[model samples]
Target: MPTKGMSPVSFSPSRASPSPSPSPSHHSPSSSPPTPRKTLSSSMIAENVDTAESIIRKWSVEDGSSSYCRLDSVFANDRTEAKDFLRSVKNIQSAMQFFVSEGTSSSSEQLVRAQKLMQMAMKRLQKEFHRILSSNRNNLDPESVSSRSSVSMSDFEDYEVASEEDDIQVTGNSVHEIVAGDSVSDLAMADLKAIADSMISSGYSKECMKIYKLVRKSILDENLYYLGVEKLSLSQIQKLDWDMVEGKIKSWLNAVKTAVKTLFLGERILCDVVFSTSPKISESCFAEIARDNAVTLFSFPEHVAKYKKLSPEKMFRLLDIYDSITDLWTEIESIFSFDSTSAVRSQAVNSLTKLGESVRAMLLDFETAIQKEGSKAPIQGGGVHPLTRYVMNYVGFLSDYSGTLSDILSDSPQNTRSPLPESYFSSPTCDDGSTSALSVRLAWLILVVLCKLDAKAEQYKDVALSYLFLANNLNYAVSKVRKSNLKLLLGEEWIENHEATLKQYTANYERMGWSKVLTSLPEENPTAEISPLEAREFFRRFNSGFEEAYKKQMSWVVPDARLRDEIKVSLAMKLVPAYTSFYNKYRGFFGREVGVVEPVVRYAPDDLGNYLSDLFYGTGAGSGSVSSSVSSSGRKVR
Candidate 1:
């Protein structure tokens, strides 16, 4: 199918075939000779090429402009031309083997002249081949370009390449026709796009991998994935605006997308290229951005009124952080979950793990922000307390998703230990401690918050209220760790310290509150001017004080069942017995005075004991209190 004006190479079918006869025959030829696998074939090629060579040798070396055209027709400005040229030289080398093997040449002189001509042409072609290879290498390596299949200029200029292996556009024009483009770069892009779009999704990753490699090449050549500079540290990374880096990556991808729009590769490969070669983002890089966005997250909008009342916003922020990180890994997880190959799977896992590590460290930024809050001068007051509620609420919040977070934080030191450091009591115990780095950091941070709360608790002028405040906080701390999975970090020992402190507060509350009432009861004053009047008055004062204590404290709430009961029991032991005894001593005096109206029979010890039962319920104190001078149940009997 050579054009009318173009010269063609004539091929000899009979010589190429295994037919012993030189001329064409009607019968099918014998099975062809096996191609020599060990060495090149020295036999002359088919009659067509042999006849064409004679014609080629007839053309003069001085054929001027026609010679250039002839060579241009044969040689492409590409790797294909160099390869073909070398292959031809190899063929000539095999042909020349006859010069050595034909031991006795009857027409020796004619054979020598023909061999000389063939040798001259082989040497000339070899020299031209090297020069062309050098030129191509300077522009781009021959090996790199040679791997790609050649596309004819006609495929782009006019002819349709839509033979099904190359896709067509909506307009029915082929991808090659659309991007056949004038230059080598354009042709490569167009051909690659055509191949990619035409390829099916399933069972073609091997072929599709070529596209990925090409993308990597383009990225390296164009410097799309990196700048010429060195890596930045976490601090410096934080300072930089990543918008440009992200934007450039997006822009490069968009160009590839637009070029390949008509011939789409699956989204999976696209994502791989986009993320893998986008840039060298490190954990430190993610740490900066994740940290900055996370800074406003964990604290109260205004100062929280009490230690236990963190707003809902704090939990919401934590959930949002978890969600954002989930989104970040979504693509990688998808790729891994698919029926990917060993190499791609390994890549996905490595990517996910590194990303998990960096972002896990980024979660520590939340720790940093929380720790920074702990760094503030703690609030010092009775009405307002430290951020115990906020801190514990966050603990419960994080614990809810520990299973999922643990997967991400797995294989890492962060997931090692159970958290919560210590209470503000300066308790005699050190943490039982977790093995992982993350657990240690989180545990220490919890202790810091407690210490802050502890310092703030000491500010109260009323010792009983202060102790009660701390006791309530400690109970809550213990309950938070005890009830949730946080027991791992804040071990049983830490929780025991909280319980002990709570009991200590209960004891302190008893000593401070009831001591005043107990001292107010006057000793017998037999020598006084009005002994009977004095006795009645002492009964009145003692009765009033005891009633006041019960009235004021009945609504105070202690959450721990055991502590609440013990406090109630202690009050009962001290108040009931003593009050009953004092009442017995004064009752006769009241009646003997005759004017005192028997000093209002008031409480029997049992009546006062009932009032003490209501202390430290979850409800706070209320103001309907009147004084009551009660003895501990044992003291009344004494």
Candidate 2:
């Protein structure tokens, strides 16, 4: 009756006609070899049969509902009763097996009776199996069971040993084991396992498995439903709006982690433990129970990837879905190791492949959009272009998913050749060669934006403003790289090089914009003595040049505060000292000739300072000029 080593045993009653001596039972000629209970007397056999009959009949379905004992209700507190019940079933089986081997008339009659009792016992166990599964749904929930299964006996022992240490700090590893195990009722698992083992050993595995598959499959499907994994088709996905698809993708991201890490994993663990004595049976059961649901869960991502209405905006979500599957791949492989569940693994792989394709396609579309941008109207004030903002922001978000992109683009084709000069679109300095694919991909996209900005800059008629447009847009792109995860991917060297190029653009703007004003002044040390008329001419030209430069540039913008201030400082350093030197040297010539130079020497050294301060604010050209505010001291009075 002990559950251990409960393999079926063979025995048979005598077939040599009834003995008039009433000599009890004896082995017949066709009887099988003797068992450990070969000497088990006729009385012992009858007693075993009768004991099993009493227990099974009590719990038989033939009884009215008032007297029907639900195994789930009783198995938890009365494990002794559960054990007794299993043992009784096994006893009935042993008795029937004995009768089958005996091959005698009376043995056959007893076999029929034992067989009836065995059937009743099996029927009761089947009900109990269904009852335990149905009633203990909360206790048998996958997440709780998974947490419990993760802890082993060694973990508990480790906890005990650590607890005994005098000054040991409990780091919660040991405590975690206790709490994890306590999350679910072990008694429920024990009851299910016991009933399973008894039924399987007694040649009723089909019934046991049928009940298990039916109940657990429903739970698995329900888990999938709650996880928000819908049975979406390609047509349906294509028809859904991006907003709805985005919501579903978000839900799937959350669901997949639970489905892969807890639901399927826990079910595998539960199946393995419940049918520990029969591994093949356990695997088959888990495969049948979870395969379809897992496929459905994994298939959702593929459906989303296959949606025809692809856009660059959806690339991040695709990357997210791809990343989730990649992150859980190892667990997925381990949980679905059985050949029967290979479709789940394949579906996951397919989803990843399709997602990579989708992501690549969207990236291409984004690049094409940048290249084909037809907005010819130049940004007023040479400020940041809309294309620049859109592209940089998109690339910045892509950099946040660099790790995922590296995996996706590792083997993906890239356009290594660039239309721009090598120096303009320089190679990125990645910390690892493995990330070169992503670095190159992102750098190329940024390069495409830069090229487009070049085309946009040409739309500005003022050559100086065109340079300013390039500087504004490039500075914006560089700043975006500096602030976001792009800094890490592109590296310091890349940032330094781009910043140098930005400096070049700034210098070009300064040269083209203020060159006329800078050249209007006499040499710092004039070679010839200047006549009064010549000095007046020099002052007139200087005043005319300064006003024209200031008025035109008043409306020009530099959006970055630091860059704006730096440019202002640079312009003042160049213009202020030279103008002061020239003015001090020549002002007396005008002063001595007319007793005042106010009519001729229009701007003071300090006035240049005030004028340069107002530059790059994008104030309108109609704004008041510094010439109207010049004071008696030849400086602009605030």
Q: TM-score of each candidate?
A: 0.41, 0.83
User: Which of the numbered candidates is closest to the native, going by highest lDDT?
Assistant: 2
What is the Cα-based lDDT of residue 128 in candidate 1? 33
Segments of candidate 2 deviating more than 4 angstroms: 1-40, 63-77, 152-184, 415-435, 524-529, 592-598, 621-638
Model 1, 1-638: lDDT tens digits are: 11221122221111121112222323347755546752242334322235434433433233353344434412334433322333333333343345334433422332344444444343333223222322332232222332222434333334223332234343322223344334543333343333222221112222334334333333222321232212223344334444543342234333322211211112223222212222222122222222221111111111111112223333333333334334434433432233322233343344345444444555565566655663344233222243777777776666665555555655666555445433422222334523334344445656666676676666666676666667667677777878876676445666676677768876887787677666655544323344666665666676677767656555455655665666666676665666667666656644444465344555566556545654555344322221344433422210
**At residue 311, what lDDT does model 2 achieve?**
90
Colliding pairs, model 2: 12-101, 12-102, 13-102
List residue ranges in candidate 1 displaced over 4 A: 1-386, 403-442, 520-541, 544-566, 592-602, 613-638
Cα distance off (Å), candidate 2, residue 446:
1.6
